[model samples]
Target chain A: MHVPVLKQGDYLIASVQSVLSDADLVQLRDDLAERVGQFRSRGVIIDVTVLDVIDSFATRTLRAVAHMLKLRGAETVIVGIQPDVAFAMVQLGLTLEGVGTALDLEEGLAYLDRLARKPVKHGK
Target chain B: MENNEACVSINSAADIVTARQKGRALALELGFDGSDLTLIATAISEVARNIVNHAKSGEIVVSPMNHSNKRGILVVARDEGPGIKDIAKAMQYGYSTNKGLGVGLPGAKWLMDEFDIESKVGKGTTVTMKKWLH
Candidate 1:
């Protein structure tokens, strides 16, 4: 069972738990992407804290979420990445690239707040 | 010899984690980077998952090797079960007989420098993978 920890505001929080397999990682990304479209103005914070391992599939899914949110005029920040897990990700040569990574829920919210204020840079 | 002295076994998922931890430790002890250790762990996890789902019981052997001018980590995944019939097809990504996403053996082979698969229809399968550190 995989649950995504999400934050709506500084204090408002919600958990989206799903039984995910390798394929479901992709599904979850799509689901989150759709959610971003519906709640772009509110911004979004996704808690991937429960994830201990980041494989190619998971990385791709996360990348998709990041792109989708960006398209919907919103910003997404990932939080609670464990150290050993980060080390594993580094070893895999996996890159978050455009996605933001935070230390915890508080940090993630803070990161999102900061992004909300920054002027959008158009890739023209 | 330093090569023969390195060995370990994993039966369950917990054992898989322990085995991978030990494998990474060995990789570090032999001067490999943490990145290599991650790939090794992923590869081992895939094989161990296969053991649990298919073989039900198997043993993994991790040994150090001096291959050419670089140090290589040799992993032998042995299992006693219904062996693989088509080695070529099995090596293809997304070609799992079981309902896997099909990124286990093929992915492991891609991550390593050398991969060899030997199996008999009714016997078992032995996969040997070696990752060379430069």
Candidate 2:
């Protein structure tokens, strides 16, 4: 099953709608990285509203994806995390510390836009 | 211990997803709220994934239970594979044998109300957990 990743201007939006296995997530990571390079996108917003559960593996995969995007000059914002998923994440102590998160897709896009407008920080 | 139980085999990643789905549906039928349902499902996913990644194969059984004046759900995941040598270390956060995040066992334990594990090296392992309705 292919996850549709739509490109909007300088941002890419990918919505996760199905139960994703480790292999699927690995595929997504590769796909997103390739797409970001091809589109020269500056930001990505991953929507996970349709996902009922986000296990430790999935959380780690998201963090990895975000790190990979950052290395490629693209910022990633995860959006639409359900409240229960959030609760479980906290309970499990899988904080996803380095990943950015937003309440919804609109908010996530806004966040990316803000980041784009900000002046890049020099070596610090 | 109610007779309404659902069981699924876990041999691959897809089977882990199936187990979580069935577990979630059962939790919903037992009147678990949205948050509780998600918690239960996530807990199931953690253990089921352990089976697929660590044990290589296993089975998950979810059942409804009634005790004293409380109702709850029970999940039992068992595998006949290389059992954990140090069950204590396996239960520690960030202690994985396969370079994983190592949150599967401990995280599942925290998500549910009760958690138990029995394992013997070169034999097998079984995890039993329960979450009572609130």
Candidate 3:
């Protein structure tokens, strides 16, 4: 299952197109982290609408992805978690806490845009 | 018995995906709804992952069943690897010796209607879970 990461302006969009295995999830994390620097991306949007189940492994790997992007001075937003998947995640105690999430691709882009419009933190 | 059963071997992380996908497909054919299908699929993923992570290899078996006219899906994950030293500790939430969230087993239990596990030190482990079509 390949997750295609597309570069859009200063943001990156990685849309999951199929059921991803553990190896695939790790590959995605590394791929995005590398692209964030190679492309000098400011934000990332991961579309998971195609995913039917996001279990513990997937959740942890995604958290790692977001954390890695943040360390590289890039923000990450996960979008398109189905309602049933969300309910299962909640029951499994797999809340994507500390990670930004939006309803879909449009909201994710809007969120990133709003963050970009704000003044840079600190005195920089 | 014609099309009510399926089995997938769990070896690598890739097998986890296969097992869960097959589980979801079987569950759907068994008349499980949207959320229930997701729940069953997630539960299978967790158990199958355990087989790969700890046992190195195993298998997941899923089948449709009936409990007094109440249809349900049964999932059984079996592996012959280093058994859990403390099943209780392993089942507890947030308890993990491996580099994981430690919620795989417990979370899987929460997602299913019925859950059971058996293990022996230095022997192996088997996890059986069920989800009713509700």
| lDDT at B80, model 2 | 95
DockQ of the two-chain complex in candidate 3: 0.89
Ranked by DockQ from best down, the candidates are 3, 2, 1
Against the true structure, candidate 3 has what lDDT? Answer: 0.92
Off by over 4 Å in 2: A118-124, B1-3
- lDDT tens digits by residue: candidate 2, B27-130: 98898999899999999999999999888998999999988899999999999989999998999999998888999999999999999999988888999999
Clash count for candidate 1 is 0
Worst ten-residue run, lDDT, model 1 chain A? A10-19
Instruction: Give me the displacement of residue A33 in model 2, in angstroms.
Output: 0.6
Query: Candidates' interface RMSDs, in order?
Result: 5.9, 0.9, 0.5
User: Please, what are the lDDT tens digits per residue for candidate 3 over residues B1-134?
Assistant: 54568899888988888898899999888888899999999999999999988999989999888778798889999999999999999999999888899999999999999999999988899999998877
lDDT of 1 by residue, B1-134 (tens): 47343455555545555556566677777778756776776676667666666676677888788857778788888888788889898878777776655666777776677888888887988888888888
User: Which is superior by lDDT, 2 or 3?
Assistant: 3
TM-score for candidate 2 (chain B): 0.96
Candidate 1 per-residue C-alpha lDDT over A41-114 given as tens digits, one digit per residue, 9 for 90 to 100: 44566666655455544666677777786787777777776676576565445578899888887887788777
Per-prediction TM-score of chain B? 0.88, 0.96, 0.96
Better of 2 and 3 by DockQ: 3
